[model samples]
Target: MDNAVRNRAWRMRRKPAGLVQQDDLELVTEAVRALAPGEVLLRLVHVSLDPGQQVYMQSTQELPGGTIWPGDVIRAWGVGEVVESRSDRFPVGSHARDHHGVAGVQEYAILPEAALILVDPEAAPLNAHLNILGMPGLTAHAGLSQIGCLQPGETVVVSGASGAVGAAAGQIARIRGCRVVGLAGGPEKCAHLTGELGFDAALDYRSGRLAADLTLACPDGIDVYFDNTGGEILDICLGQMARKGRIVFCGAIAAYGSGDSRGLTNYLRILTHQVRFEAFAYYDYEPHFASALAELAGWMQAGLLKHREDVAVGLENFVPVFHHLFTSGISGKLVLQVRDGVTR
Candidate 1:
């Protein structure tokens, strides 16, 4: 372990106004400081790019204020290989990641022992830990089973269905015997939802026929609506919810870019339909993570659940790739390869 080793990370340069621009962040290089007795030196392999993390770069109504300040490293969830370790929990050459702490957008990280979670590279692709086997999959499971109270034979609708959490939620609903319908932005994503991920039906929200298309897909009304995009799509789902239905509020990607938080006029349907509208935060269900991961892994191994990742190589591509989330530039879980030539 050498303190002379250099680390590269993306640091916030300015508070982004609407969408995060390239100029808002700066690529910084510094010497990797020596690890303490209970710390680990990680060569970050893949960094998970999520829509919610973008809000930390700027303020939004949901978050109220920005959590990250200028000059701070952009935080994300990521998997890394322990190249040097002063802790027994994380040995040299072991793979680990953190969903609970700041796994920044960097090529190398010096993290505390408690902040790391060990992952098996042989169990699944290393990147899988950042997606289906990680937060996105766990979020989907907890939302559907614990929050949504999803039942077999019920009709479940997922908005932003091609994205990470949405994709997992739709498949998990299907695995649990629900008739799953997905809504996405384009025809290609819609097709991938139904044809690849096994969603029962898919509708393009960009077609300007969302209401009619959704109505046709869920003739009996949606029993559980996994809402990832919380704008007009949410309002449409609100009006079409079945009696005693549930709405799992996982994300608000629709408002993230535009900053136009269109209020749901059909919110009154919550009372009329006796619906349960609840927001999901994965930390609330942390106690169940091990079991959830095991189940998701089994599903993946058994060919029941499938996950996709849009991996962009090099740390330099982080800014443009991160912007892709809102523009639908990539499909599935977005990941940035911070280090090159590390075989998966």
Candidate 2:
């Protein structure tokens, strides 16, 4: 094991403003110390740039004692290969994915064996581990099956439907025989959701007539609502929900970096309609991960599932590429390819 290896990482420079700026993250280089027992040195290949990163930076939420601060290594989900191993769990040259949140936005990461989930590159493309076969896929399965308790012939509505989690959730619901409707930002994404992803309907939320479009698409009323962008769209869905509907609150990208809350005036409908509103984290359902992964893998192999990735090449381009996540209308999962030729 080489203790002289240099690691380049991106740390939070400061809390973001209205939108994430380049100054919010600073790249730093440090020498990697030798691994301890049960530790493995990982060479990061693909780092997931998720909307949750923005929430972690601004929110006061903390692990146990302290909140995330400037100079702290920005936590992320990534795929890496074990370069040096002191544990049998992760032998050298084996690829693994972060379990909960140990991996960060760095070229090299030293993680304990317990935090690493062994991945098979031969099963699917390496980047798929960061998208459909990763946390987003688990989030979708848990939210739809467990939280939403989705049933066949039910009308399901998913906001931010073209996004990673949202897209997966919609497809999962569709596979379960639900009539899935998606709400995306533009016509292009809406088209992709309906045309490619097999959603029953795709509505452009940016269109002023969200209520009208939703009514037209979901004539049966929404039995389940998978919310990723919680704001006006959520309120609209809440008002149009069927009696005893279920809402799985997965993400609130609409409120991220805005520093302002869009109060849900229609929350009273939860009581009137007897709706069940539940918020879930993917890690909370870890016990069911193996089943979910097997199902998702089978669907992919049988051509029942499809996934897209918007990859941004180069580690140095992390800042601008991260900013592109919010501003640019890039669809699918956003991943940072820190190193190339290793996966392909």
lDDT tens digits, residue span 1-344, model 1: 45978999999998898888899899989989888899998888999998987777886343432367788888888798898999999999899998674788998888898878899898889999989999899999999989999889999999989999999999999999999999988889988998999999999999988899888988899999999999999999999999999999988999986878988999899999999999978878888988998999999999999999988999988888888898888888999988677645
lDDT per model, in order? 0.89, 0.87
Off-target runs (Cα >4 Å) in candidate 2 are: 63-67, 340-344
Which pairs in model 2 have colliding backbones? none
Give stretches of model 1 more than 4 Å off.
Answer: 60-66
What TM-score does candidate 1 reach? 0.95
Error (Å) of candidate 1 at residue 287 is: 1.2
Candidate 2 lDDT, 231-302, residue by residue in tens? 899999998989999999998888888765779889898999899989888878989999999999999998
Best by lDDT: 1
Model 2 TM-score (2 dp): 0.96
